[model samples]
Target: AQSVTQLDSHVSVSEGTPVLLRCNYSSSYSPSLFWYVQHPNKGLQLLLKYTSAATLVKGINGFEAEFKKSETSFHLTKPSAHMSDAAEYFCVVIGFSGTYKYIFGTGTRLKVLA
Candidate 1:
């Protein structure tokens, strides 16, 4: 079984600065983790994913996350923030509770400041 937790309800970053969103997870086996972003009035979009094949995963819009197995954490980061990056980001994991299913974390709302 696996579950995910988003550590922040909101994160504000200045435009052109770095962005970091924290996430933690628990699983009985090697878990697959994903990051999704949702803009206002739009559907959720997959940002990145960490499967067994990779430790560091890169995603769209300059976003990336590293899987730390020891810490049970997968934190999202971007070197530079754009105003358009303002959105709701969710940390997701698949759980094996009888059947495999998706579990989502409490989303982190990112606000970009001018």
Candidate 2:
């Protein structure tokens, strides 16, 4: 079984500062991980994804994440924070063991301060 845990329920960052959101997962095998952001009354958008291909993955809005197998962690980071970045972020994990299953984290809400 695969499960995702978002370490923080809320994160606050000042504009122009760096942003970091932590996520951890557990799976019997290598699993696919992803970060998705959802704005108010909007659909979820893919921030970044980690497959077997690359350990470090980059995505839209200057966001990036590194897959660490040893630590069982895939943490999202941004060089700079923007007001528009304020949203709910979810950590998702997909594991394929005979059957495919998806596990989602509780989510971390990001608030950008001027």
**In lDDT terms, which candidate is top?**
1
Q: After superposition, how far is residue 31 of candidate 2 from its true place, in Å?
A: 0.8
Ten consecutive residues with minimal summed lDDT in candidate 1?
A: 93-102
Off by more than 4 A, model 2? 96-99
**lDDT of candidate 1 over 1-114, digit per residue (tens):** 678999999999999999999999999889999999999999999999988878999999899999999999999999999999999999999987688889999999999999
Give the per-residue lDDT digits (tens) of candidate 2, residues 12-45. Answer: 9999999999999998888899999999999999
Deviation from native of the Cα of residue 22 in model 2, angstroms: 0.2
**Clash count in backbone of candidate 1:** 0
lDDT of 2 at 78: 97
Q: After superposition, how far is residue 97 of candidate 2 from its true place, in Å?
A: 7.2
